[model samples]
Target chain A: MASTEQEVLEGLAEIVNEETGIDTAEVELDKSFTDDLDIDSLSMMTIVVNAEERFGVRIPDDEVKNLKTVRDAVTFIQSAQS
Target chain B: MTSSSDTRIVVTGLGATTPIGGTVPETWEALLAGRSGARTLEFDWVAEYSLPVHFAAQIATPPEQVLAKVETRRLDPSSQYALVAAREAWADAGSPDIAPERIAVVVGSGIGGVHTLLNQWDTLREKGPRRVYPLAVPMLMPNGPAAAISLELSARAGAHTPVSACASGAEAMGYAVQLIRSGRADIVVAGGTEAAMHPMPIAGFAAMQALSTRNDDPAAASRPYDTDRDGFVLGEGAAIIVLESEAHAQARGARIYAELAGVGMSADAHHITAPEPEGSGAARAMLEAIETAGAALSDIAHINAHATSTPVGDVAEANAVRRAFGELAGSIPVSATKSMTGHLLGAAGSLEAIFTILSLHHRVAPATINVDNLDPEVGLDVVRGEHRALPEGPIVALNNSFGFGGHNVALAFRSV
Candidate 1:
């Protein structure tokens, strides 16, 4: 019923960068949240919370813990959507 | 393994912004008087949300009144509550002139910034992503409260956040005690904050039948251990205490309220939401705490229970009390302040710990209000109606906290 990967990525991109004053770009998707993008654990939680609200699905804490990459998050969101 | 003699922690300061009162003295005074902070919902949004539970223990005053407008605007309500409590605690500890490297913070919360998360989601959906606030992420993080407090004190030791549901606050306190004992930090600002009186949380708990639906009488809704008890009322706010090593407190001439004797943590590993039927894990936690405190069971005069008024939770905790203290548990007075203050979730344990320390300081146990009829299954001596005088001289009190995911924590305090 929902566009999974694209929507999730787009939603995640909308999460504001506190230091940069811009959206997380597509090129930065593969970069580590902490090292390259400056996305910390709090930012990750915000992304998760936004995703949950958008998809109307409860992301299990264990699964959230496993989501390390943008691709991983996309896959999880796809599976959760189905 | 560290020896018991190696770690001696004392409560150097106390702070709180509870439903009963805004500051430590105010909250303690109202608690000792057995005042109920529960009241009927007066917000017009309640009608819009159509929430089943009509009452909650909201902070008597909003933090905005106490904090700068710019500061309050950027921080989440949970973080705001934590900062308010932390500032009071820091000052209460005589603003100890310790090096920043020697200080630490371990404030926790079960559901941090639910209100912020939900509100921001609405903004994103309705007003577009461009309109979403930049501070949303920082405000909604579960660790935001702890981080904010750590920043306030410039604590370089470490800032830790434990998310063990309702047991989070007590776990934070427990972690702080360990830090002092392990010489990791000479002083730690520890406690919890929660501002989850949001519609979604209320609705979710109501869907699980975890909240009382007594819309008619909001004041009597959270009736723990009573035969007529239904479920808990939701509450919000924060509580924090400044914990320091005995040597540190003595050197600084800090006024010690009580000694944090010991802490024990256990998990049921059985249910995600429901507590174990036999309360075996809970009993083990209490026993382990007493052992860690290096105190006898007979030395415990009071127990601040994690009785949230849920039909199953109250009975299981009572059984756990009986199991841990055995025959003596019946004689020891238990106070279920949730009856008066409602269930604070993450903040419950920390606030209740403060209550336990105050009980020692004042030599009086606060009454459990709205309990018209005691449940037969809960046979413990639950102090009700009027404040009960605690036994004089050096005494110990236990604060029990059981959370979702079967997390159980017990903290013991001895009169200084």
Candidate 2:
């Protein structure tokens, strides 16, 4: 099983931003990429690709389509890890 | 009674997440420069499956470089590619200030979220049903790409998916044109996306002998119209274009690419996997498109062919081209771009349509790469090696797409 929510967040924080010298903590779970983090579509796709690599599980196209929030992604990762 | 002038629909913006490039400009540049996106699989499952055809045109820029860590976990790769392309097109269209009800989205795919389906099945077997994510249904659905775009644009007119195998993308663009012409929507985001570079699809295609087995030369493997052409190479990517009514485009001062003159669709009803031997249905579709556009056969200067490099498919499409062009067949230049891009399956048609429009806009038709020995059976003028320059002044080009289910679609575009 995966770690607790906070631990998962801490682990994800190490992912690192190639553009800006920052951590995943800069991206709030609820804030939309277009609005909050300034993440574009290409950036969003990179995030998904990284998540699949990190979690070692494949996220389906349908589920990825609805992933507008950070919580949706974390919950999905948790389920995949289980 | 005098007929009113037909409303001209033009391509206002283009976006693509293709095997060669991430955006439309990048893909277009690579396509013209003759870059090959095909490469061997880096995934470990390739060795496990013992797949014969190992290479594929995976997206040059992976989505992981762009998406957030958590956000990436929830969606399938197909949807991610679609969204990536859609955002570029939407922004390229200057983010039109239109009501949600007046916008529509039509993005199709041959195989939607197969990666998600296979992976989830692995999870179910390795772990348990409770471990499966709840969003599997949405991810695996064929309409996932179109639905995601609809939500992004807040399109309410309708969101549609045309799953006509390889012709899916072209058909979606056709549907978008109709939506605007029929007064359903003022603008539409239309194209196709596919991320089926998985072990199952690759193994399945290899089993069917549908993919090229020239693993030694990945780039030269997808050789359309060549004497040694075996089969198409599998590819993954998305291409989306913004189609708007002429009136709306003029009002907004949009930079129009080319007027989407007309579209013709037909069904072979001959075979599920094979095209009609004489290419009757494909010919009919092309002829219908010419008639719909009210253009003479001689008006078409070029054709962006959906030559998937399959031995039978190439000949069938070649026959169709010769039949449709008739006396002008020898003059019109036909470009088989799959020579470079491989078979994008569902997204082939839409991306090819973009190629056609660009050819018209720039007056330069990109050459069909890797055709060292053209099949003598192909009668039409097949452009090869270097790009060919088109004759000056209002030129029309045809984009053809044919799917596995014998679905034939032809779209005609004229320079603005």
Best by TM-score: 2
lDDT (Cα, tens digit) per residue for candidate 2, span B14-38? 8898888888899989989998888
Q: Write the per-residue lDDT of candidate 1 for residues B290-348, one digit (tens) a residue.
A: 99999999999999999999999999999999988889979999999988778888999
For residues A1-82, what per-residue lDDT tens digits would candidate 1 score against the true structure? 5565667677656643423344557424575556666566655666676667666666776787787777777677777778
TM-score, structure 1 vs. true: 0.83
Worst 10 residues of 1 chain B by lDDT: B1-10
The regions of model 2 sitting more than 4 angstroms off are A1-82, B1-5
Fnat by candidate, in order: 0.00, 0.00
lDDT of each: 0.86, 0.85
Model 1: pairs clashing at backbone N, Cα or C within 3 Å? none
Each model's chain A TM-score: 0.73, 0.73
